[model samples]
Target: MPVRTADAALAGVRRGVGAERLTGRTALVTGSSRGMGRAAAIRLAQEGALVAVHYNRDEAAAREVVTSVEKDGGRAFAVRGELGVDGDVDGLFAVLEEDLRERTGSTDLHILVNNAGVMGGVGADEVTPEQFDRIFAVNAKAPFFLIQRALRNMPDGGRIINISSGLTRFANPDEIAYAMSKGALEQLALHFAKALGPRRITINSVAPGITRNGNPVFDIPEVVEQMAGLSAFGRVGEPEDVADVVAFLATDEARWITGSFVDATGGTLLG
Candidate 1:
């Protein structure tokens, strides 16, 4: 279908979403209080989904995200639960159900964005059992179990996007545990793609490379240039860069894509 004119394109786009791009859908983006997850939550709301902004300890930040969404004339709410702890998933969903039902009259989730994760804990040689377990607990175990619980409420044609990293595809010894956990998460997507195909549910991983998620490391000019030089575009990624890919996956336009690793790396793998 060729889009003819500017006005026609605008009309077509508005019609596609019935309001924006994800209207009548409900999305829950974890770790949404800040960073890439926060960008995804806001993007989903802009596209017309009723967003559940999940946070760990920053209620103010979470509420701020909700406020931002509402300020843009979108609907959103906050759900708080610290991941990587026992009964964490249960507590997360308890808040999700009560809050979601109160707003939308149903607890069904159409999109689940597993963006909450941990990066650094300890170097491998200095890695203790507690360190390893905590890494996997937050990065791997939390998403694994969160999906298990979300499946009961997620209906057919639901979308599950796991936020992965470019490190999994390359050799990065510094973040070994973090990369391994993301690898495990990709495997979950591969296996579940077939497992959930019968239900028309799509699961995929979006791997980002050297993203500028408001970290102070990028604040240094030399560090910023060094990171940007790694990409073929000679630029680092922004939170919205990854969030755009994730937002596309949440829509019906990406229905054909599943069980794949989307490289949102700006050509960082071109070596």
Candidate 2:
């Protein structure tokens, strides 16, 4: 089986997530310049939320996302700050709050999607202390702090979604450190859902497996087939697949659900 190109895979799969269920709401998706983050940003905007497209260094790509959202008749803006660095969250929120206050006359954020992460530190033997620290810093610490700051302005009944990975549930020795980092990320949802319950804020983690994100290896038929077979659906996961889940979590439909690990993995490795 040939690997499905991104265009082909998304051709029919892309559509509006809701009929303005999130109208008048504001969302911030981190690392949204490309991949799942880009897709999630677009999906949230489609639901009528004013989106904040956050990027680390790709200002051009981030601008494109803002343009895409605008072209779709939705409102969006781009914010830049490199995660895992000192003052990253503060710097990001500065620009974000400025935009929010200017646009809506308020700094209230309704949804926060912690989608930014690093994916190195391969295995135990190959992993170095530097890599482990960086991985945890980006994947775990950054989101932890971002949530800490977001809650201040996030109103009651807000939604917080952390983009996690299937490696947290399934074993992947090759990604030991990365998996550990994501595992720590999952704990954020579990713990915060309880702590923030009084405020009616719901926090959850969405785990995706072997998602295609424009990687060159996915262009190879053999590699695609091998990965596709791992999923119960007999196809590789697409960004839209997980983005839909993220959008749902942000909606009122998922209000009863919190402190959950949602499997957006195309049923990967389910015998």
Highest lDDT scorer: 2
- The digit string of per-residue lDDT tens for model 1 on 26-129 reads 99999999999998998888889999999998999999999998987889999999999999999999989999899999999999999999886456787777
Q: What are the lDDT figures for the candidates, one per model? A: 0.87, 0.92
Off by over 4 Å in 1: 1-19
lDDT of 1 at 158: 97
Candidate 2's displacement at residue 85, Å, is 1.3
TM-score computed on alpha carbons, candidate 2: 0.95
Candidate 1 scores a C-alpha RMSD against the true structure in Å of 5.8
Worst 10 residues of 1 by lDDT: 1-10
lDDT of 1: 0.87
